[model samples]
Target: MRTLKKVGFSLISIILFALLSYVVLDFLVPKSNSSSSENEEIAQQQSRVFLDLVAVGDSLTEGVGDSTQRGGYVPLVADMLRTNPNVKNVQTANYGHAGDTSSQLMNLLEENEEAQADLKEANIITLTVGGNDLIRNFRQVGLNGSVEDFETTIQEYEENLNSIFSLLNQYNDEASIYIYGLYNPYHYYFAEFEGLQAVFDLWNERTVEIAENTDNVTFVEIDSLFNPSDAPTETEVESNSGDSLEDIQDTNHPYLFEDDLFHPNDSGYKVMASALREAIEKELEDTDSLLSMNR
Candidate 1:
């Protein structure tokens, strides 16, 4: 009897211990799951929720060289944004017009009520200007045009660009604005004219300065992506003994449209779209970091 009692007691003790262990494990498993779920929720919160993109400006934004007539980088960016798991949906409003200068864009911004409404609702705004302005100056003066010749044009462009930013802010202070920098399309035509390249560089510099001054403004540079060149200037041409224009000029640039050789072809627009997507992602990541820090 004593042996039996001892055996029973041992069995009971073992059963109790096993039950307790099971209960403890069950509780801990749930807690772990809850913690993991909470972490997932936090991560989701850090991601951008939605994007309402508004594209406004000149031929690039208007998708001039796009063979599909799909509005060039505008649609491409929207498609890219949709791939983000956090973004539920994406809507785009294209206000892009061909041959619009900065001043003309500003005027449109001030005058177009519909565009103003769209701006107010947009979360992302992309502007492409200054190309027409530069091209106009280039057309007027040609390769012989001095840097001084473009100074006046750049100054005017600066004022117009500032006004454009002001108008955008006035219409929608909450939206992030992205302005594209000008590329030297004429690089192919005037590779030896360092003056034109200098003018293009100066224009981009002024544009960057303007963008820096404005809040929530990002400048996207497409110069080097499409038309990268280190061709000799007029002075370099004079000094070099054996270098020919054909050697310096890269006529094989595949990005340019064969018809005009000025506008970006389909492949070129894809490049621009990629740049815009990267810029948007970077900006959003920075914003997420700030939000995480604040939390």
Candidate 2:
């Protein structure tokens, strides 16, 4: 009987020990989770150095071209980079209000307000500005429906851009600037607006000149990317979709591609993001290759 009693007591103790271990583990589990979350955050922060990128521009920078959340390509591009361990945590402050010209963008930078606090940490930038100026110029010359007088339009455009470039150096010359070259939207409207294919071509020519003058700046030639000749009419809007350009732009201005007639649809912005990614990848790869070669 005594032996039987000893076995019972041992069994009880073993059960109690198991229960206590479970209780202790339960308490520590939350701490483990907390530590894991912290580790993940650290890894994210360590993945990329561009923790802040301040984008100042017109509607495209604000993401007006696409019909998705985050509206345009910059955020999508940011999300794309954020997925890789070597390229995550690239943050941005998007100040791309609708109808803003280059001069207005300069003002936004100068003010350093409205999430302005984020600007100090900015390490890179992407923007598109010349389009609105050209449209406005076209309107002034009564070529509102056509791009007839693109030469005079381009001349004024260049002067405004020079001012914008000078202003950028003041903020952060170290930041790499990626400028999307002007698009060929007029072809979407008029094939030859008022005898002005020359004007449109000249406008792009000036941007190439602008890109050449600035050392840390490069032109992401978006003109050909949106080509009706090679690409379809519509574009894809979702961040993760495999939609084509022909799927996005159908009307004079898709609400997704443009907010009213002036801005781009969300789909348009998606295309921009798609284009921006190609440019950035090439640049970063070139930089890495050059570094490896020197070593």
lDDT values for all models = 0.83, 0.65
Clashes of 1: 0
Clashing pairs in 1: none
Q: Distance from true position, residue 106, model 2, in Å?
A: 2.4
lDDT, model 1, position 94: 93
Query: What is the C-alpha lDDT profile of model 2 across 1-295, one tens digit per residue?
Result: 9999999999999999999999999887666778889998896555344435677777777766455657477787888766644454676778778788776766776775654455444556777887787768777775443444556656766777787777666665656678887776655544435444455567778888988998677787765656546433333232235655455344443323444444556656656777777666665556453232222
Report the poorest 10 consecutive residues by lDDT, candidate 1. 286-295
Please state the error at residue 137 of candidate 2 in Å. Answer: 1.7
Q: How large an RMSD does model 2 have?
A: 11.2
Best by TM-score: 1
Per-model TM-score on C-alpha atoms: 0.80, 0.66
